[model samples]
Target: MTEIIDYGRFADRLAAPRPRWDLLREFQDEWGYTVPAGVDPWPKWSESEHHAYVRALHEEWTGEEEDPFQGVDRTLPVPKALDEWWDLPFNSFTYSPRLYWTNPEYPLTLRPDPSGYGVSEGLPEPNPFVEPGGDLRLCCFMAEYEYCNEWAYLASEAGHDDPRVLASVGEDGWVLQARSISEFFVLLAAVRLPSHFGWSVQLGDDDFPDGPPVRERIEAAYRPMGFQNWRELGADTALFGGPDVIVRHDTGMADFAVEISGRSRDALAATARTLGWTWDEDLVEPPRKDEESQ
Candidate 1:
C-alpha cells in the first residue's frame, strides 16, 4: 500500500506555493490509483501515428488533396500552465485535447508539427460564446456540463499563464469556480480520479438506517479527502479515500447521500462491511433499495 500522506485541506492545497500542475502530478502519484485511458490522447498511439491520424482525419473531412498540414502548425496554442496540465496523464476529466501548441511541449507531447510554422491556427478558431462584451474570451479549456446546462472555462486574455475559472448557471451569470484554472483542475481530479475506475454508488440515509454515524464511520476507516464543495454544480461533497476505495457524501441539489467506488466488487463489499452500508449485490453494480424501487 502507498504510504499515507496528508494533503491538508482541499482549498489550501490549491493555494499552496507549488505550481498547479506540479501539485496535481504530486497528488496523483501519491493517490496510488491506476489511471485508465479514459482521458488524454497520447500514449494510446505513438506520437507520429497520432499526428498522421489527425492529418488523415482532416483530409477525410475537408478533402483538400493539398496537404492542409503543409507548412501548418499543430502544437497546441495554449498557455504554460495549460500546457503542463495537458502533459499530465488523463488530465482534467473534461479537458478534451485541442488539435492546436505554443513552443511549449510536454513536460514534448506531440512534437513540433515539424518545424516550418504558418501564420494560421492550423484549425479554425472556435467561436467564443462567453463574456460576449468583456475580456473573458474563450480559449483552449472550455468546460461545459452538458447535462446541467452549465459551463466554465479559463476566462482570460490570450497568452495568460493562468486565469480565473468561471462557470455559468441557468442564465444567473458566471460564478467564480476557482481563482485560477489550475485549481479547478485539482478539483476535477478529486472526483474524476475515482470515477475513472467506472463504479459509483450513491447512498441515502435509508440505505444504512441502523449503521453508525455516517461521518464517524467514514472517518474511522478512511482518510477524508477534503474535496471542495462544488456549489456551482449545486452540490457539496464529503469525500473519503482508503485502500482501494473512495466514498463521497453528497448533499444539496438532490439528496444527502454517499457515493462509493472501489477497484473491484470485493473491495466494494469490504468497504461496505467496514462502514455498515449495504446494497443488493445481485443487481448489476450495487444499487440502493431506493434506486432499485425506482
Candidate 2:
C-alpha cells in the first residue's frame, strides 16, 4: 500500500522553505487555492464546490442548464489538415483515448462527480501493460506537465486511494503517476500548428535501444501523413506544445490511455489505422447517464 499524507499539511510543509513557500503561495493565488505557512483551521471547499465551478463553466459554454452530475467537455479546437491524434487502449479506465475533431461550437467540458470534483475516477483494474521486468514507466505531456505531477501528489496526500495517484519509482528511473494523462490531453488540444504542419512525437530517455524503435515507428507514420511541426502550431503557453498525442505504453499492464488533439476526426481515424490501432465510435461520444436511464 502507498503511504498517505494530509495534503493540507504537506502544502504547509512545502511553504516552510522561503522560496518554495513563496512559489506555493503564488501557485495557490494564481490557481485560486488557499495556502499558508502552516495548516489553516478553516475548512476547504467541499468536493461539491469544485464540481459546481466546473459545471458552471460548462453550462456557460454549452448554453445549457447547469447539471453538477454531468461531465465537462475539455476538448479544444485545432487545425483540419494536421490530423493530430492519440489512442487509448479500450481496457484502461483512467481515461478515454478516442478524442476526435468536432465542430468549433462543441466546447469540451469536464464532467463533475457527486462531490463536484473534476478528477476522473481510477481504472477498475491495475495497468498490466508495463513490461513485467521493466524498471521504467514513461508518461509524456504536451502541456502543464509539472502541474499534473503536483496534482497527483496532492490527490495522494488527500487520502485518495487510486493507484494512478500513487508515486511509484520504476526500475528504469521513471516516476509513474496519474495526473500526467490529463495534462497531456489538455496540451494536445491547445496546441496550434502552422498551416499544413504537424507536431513530432518525443519521449524522454531515448538512450535505451528499446525506446527508439517505438519513436521511429511513430515518426515514420507522421512524415507521410502531412502533419506539421509543433512550434508552428502556436504552442506559446507553458501548457502547450510537444507531441500532439501522448500515449502511455506499459509492459506490466495490458491497458493504456490515449489522448489526441482535436484536429480532424477523419485524419485522426486515418492516423490510428497507420499505427494498427482502432477506436470505438461509441466511446468517442461523451458520457451521458441520463440517456441510459431512459
Candidate 3:
C-alpha cells in the first residue's frame, strides 16, 4: 500500500533546493519514475501549491524572507492520479482546439501554408445576415494559450444558438470564429464598448495606413460605450505587424481590419459613429458586393 503524502505540505517544502531533491527521491521511490538530479523541479511541478513553493523559495533566495507560504498547510491529500497528472504539463497534454460542426459537410481543416505556418481553413458560406457582397473574415489575437481556449469555448457555445457564427479550430488550439466584417465589428465593439469589460484590438493585414484617423475613430466609438484606454489594452506582439492602434484589456484581444469593405461596412461605420467616432477617407473604404459568384 502506498502512503498518501500531504501534497500541500510537500509542495511547500519542494521549493527549497534540499527539500526539492528529497521530494524527487520520494517521488522516484513512490511512483517509480526517474527524476534527473540537479534539475529545478519547481519548474516541472504543476500544482498551484508547487508554484507557491517555488515563489517562496525565490523570495528567500532574494533575501525577501517573506514567508508567503506561511499558514499554508505543508501537506494535503494527494490524489491517487497525482503522478499521472504530473507526468506532463497540464496545458500541454490536455488543451484541445476543435470546431463543433452544425453542418457536418463543412468540416474545418488546419492547413500549413508554403512557409509551413498553419492557419485554420474551410470557412462555410457567408451568413445571410451579412448584406450581399460583404467581406466576412475574423482575426483573433491571442497571447496566452488559456485565453485561446476560453475564446474557443465561448464561440462554440455561441455557435450552438447562432448558426451564423462559424468557427474553425487552429493548430495552435484556438477557435477562430468565421465572422462577416459586420459581425466582427459588432462583436469587437460589444466587448470593447462595455465599461466593465476588458479586451484589446489591433489592425489586421487588411487594414491600411493604420494611421491616427482610424485610431481616433475606434477610440471615440468605444469611449462612450465605456471602453477603457485603447493604447494600454493593446498587445505589443509582432502579430499585428505593429497595428496603427492596439486595444488591450483584461480578458480578450482582437485584430481589426479597418480598411476591409463589405455590405456590413456601413453598419460598422454607423456603429462607430453612434459611439462618437470620427474617421477620414483613408480610414474608410467603400463596401464591396459579395464576389462569391465572381
Taking all chains together, each candidate's TM-score versus the true structure is 0.52, 0.23, 0.20
Question: Residue-wise lDDT of candidate 2 within 1-294, one digit each (tens)?
Answer: 022222223223332534322332332222222222232221111222333466588778989876532333223222221112122221111121122121111112221123333232321223442344432222111112211111122222222221232222222212233332332222233231111122122222232234235434454543221112112111211121122232222223212222232223444455445454445564342222222211
Please report, in order, the local distance difference test score of every candidate based on alpha carbons.
0.49, 0.27, 0.28
lDDT of 3 by residue, 62-137 (tens): 8775433242222322222223322433111112111110111001111211211113332234543334454333
Give candidate 1 misplaced runs (Cα > 4 Å): 1-16, 26-79, 89-140, 145-160, 198-200, 211-226, 231-238, 241-245, 254-256, 263-274, 283-294
TM-score attained by model 3: 0.20
lDDT at residue 271 of model 1 (Cα atoms): 77
- Minimum summed lDDT over a 10-residue window in model 3 is located at 97-106
| Candidate achieving higher lDDT, 1 or 2 | 1
Model 1 / residue 182 / CA error / Å: 1.7
Steric clash count of candidate 2: 40
Model 2: weakest 10-residue lDDT segment is 97-106
Higher TM-score: candidate 1 or 3?
A: 1
What C-alpha lDDT does candidate 3 achieve relative to the native structure?
0.28
